[model samples]
Target: MKKLVKLIAILALVSLSQISVAGDPVEKKSEMKMDHAMGTMDESKMMEHLKIRQEEMLKMHDLSNKILAETDPNKKQALKDQQLELIKAEHIQMMSMHHPKMMKMDK
Candidate 1:
């Protein structure tokens, strides 16, 4: 009798788990539509971001060339350090902009 009860309990738990795992079809369809819309929006935004980044990189390249041409050792080192910091800051800003909600939660 105890063995039978244990088997029934296990079967009940398995069935319940399966029921919960099976999502509603309508909800799934709606979620897919929303995801598609979001994906399209993100693609456009990503392209714009890439264009801006390219422009920024070009400017940075020019600045870097200028720094490299500097003759003073101390001034060159300072400019190099400043450029490194600027690159780091831009990287962080881009990441945060791409994942705004996640970045906010992280803070």
Candidate 2:
């Protein structure tokens, strides 16, 4: 009878510990609500970011092809320089989007 009581007590403690580990339901609900709100905003921003990235990638691809096709060394070097400038401009644009304050510091 004593062993049976001890076993039941241990089982109850284990079950109670599992419930505590589950965490606060109210906090979890609030977090879920916040996540849902932010997710919508982030989705739109993410799509816009992807569109900008696509444009930059297409421009870079075209420039790379032009650079490869050019036979004159001076013209090829000019194309390469142009490509470098494009990359720098893209970096600045991305930084401005994510860190507008940092962009001001760059100037």
**Structural similarity to truth (TM-score) of each candidate:** 0.46, 0.52
- Which stretches in model 2 have alpha-carbon errors above 4 Å? 1-49
lDDT for predicted candidate 2 compared with the true structure: 0.52
Please write out the lDDT profile of model 2 over residues 1-107, one tens digit for every residue. Answer: 65674465345333322111112233422222224444544565556545544554556667767876899999999988986666555454445545779989979
What is the per-residue lDDT of model 1 for residues 13-94, given as tens digits with 9 covering 90 to 100? 3332211111223332222222444465446555654454455555455556667588999999987786666555554544
At residue 104, candidate 1 shows an lDDT of 88
Per-model CA lDDT versus the true structure: 0.50, 0.52
Report the backbone clash tally of model 2.
Answer: 0
Error of 2 at 85 (Å): 1.3
| Model 1: CA > 4 A from native | 1-37, 41-51
Give the CA lDDT, 0 to 100, for residue 92 in model 2: 49
